[model samples]
Target: MPTHFIKLKPSAVDEYKAIHAAVWPGVLAALERAHIVDYSINHYPPLQLLIATMKYVGDDYDADMKKVAEDPETQKWWAATDGMQESFATGATGSGKDIPWWTEVEEVFRFEGTS
Candidate 1:
């Protein structure tokens, strides 16, 4: 299994919080079916930033992303909330990427005190 991490700047804290408060049911189901496990998002209030992590356990990551993208309900859900996001330079406008609202990062540590 490999872990992916990403970060995004929220258009507004309340707007971001509201959508996450009730993630759409269809999207949630798609996430599990696509082998996305242990997903989570953390926030930095002062910076209005969000960091997300998802674990994937498969050889073909692109296949999983395709499954997620192909779901009709997931598409609808994204359409409704797309405007609430603010993209960083790397984000594609109205085009889906590995992470919808965030940019990926290279992992530098696993356990804080392992060394």
Candidate 2:
């Protein structure tokens, strides 16, 4: 499972929430095809940030991501959503690696309940 932290532009927060409120079926299908399960996106109004958590069951993360990226419907969805996101640079030293849209976050702690 991977958790991603991303920030939304102040102006785009509302629209971003609205769009996800009724996610497109094609987009959902694409995610399933990519072996992305238990995906959830949470919004923090005060910070205007979005936290996305998902479980990746696929063996090849990069390949699955590429497959999802190549999907026409997914591309269309991103076209509408990407503009609403804020991009992040790798680090303070001006690293060439730019996090695309969602910045990856390292999970510090986790707790599971036993039934």
Candidate 3:
């Protein structure tokens, strides 16, 4: 399971929210096909930040990500969504490359519910 923190431009907040309100079915299917589960996206209005959390059930994160990226529908979705995001600062991600968007944050703490 992994959680990611990302930021959105203030001007694009409304458009981003509106789009996610009715996400395309193919996008959802792509995520599931990538072995991604428990996906959630949250917004902070004041900061215009979006935090995404997901459990990756697959063994290979990179490979699953590549599959997701290669999906035509997913690419179309990103084409519409990418412009609303802000890129991470250089050296902000482990990839050693400037991430096009959504900077990854190191989780500092977590509390699990006792079931």
Per-candidate Cα lDDT values, in order, are 0.68, 0.78, 0.78
Write one digit per residue (lDDT tens) for candidate 3, span 2-38: 7666678898988998999999999999899999988
Question: Model 1 clash pairs?
Answer: none
User: In candidate 2, which residue pairs get closer than 3 Å at backbone N, Cα or C atoms, i.e. clash?
Assistant: none
The TM-score of candidate 3 is 0.84
What's the TM-score of every candidate structure? 0.75, 0.83, 0.84
Clashes per candidate (backbone, < 3 Å):
0, 0, 0
The root-mean-square deviation over C-alpha atoms between each candidate and the true structure, in angstroms, is 3.7, 3.9, 3.3
**Tens digit per residue, CA lDDT, model 2, 6-45:** 6688899778989999999998998999999889988888
Best of the two (1, 3) by TM-score: 3
Model 1 bad stretches (over 4 Å):
1-11, 95-101, 112-115
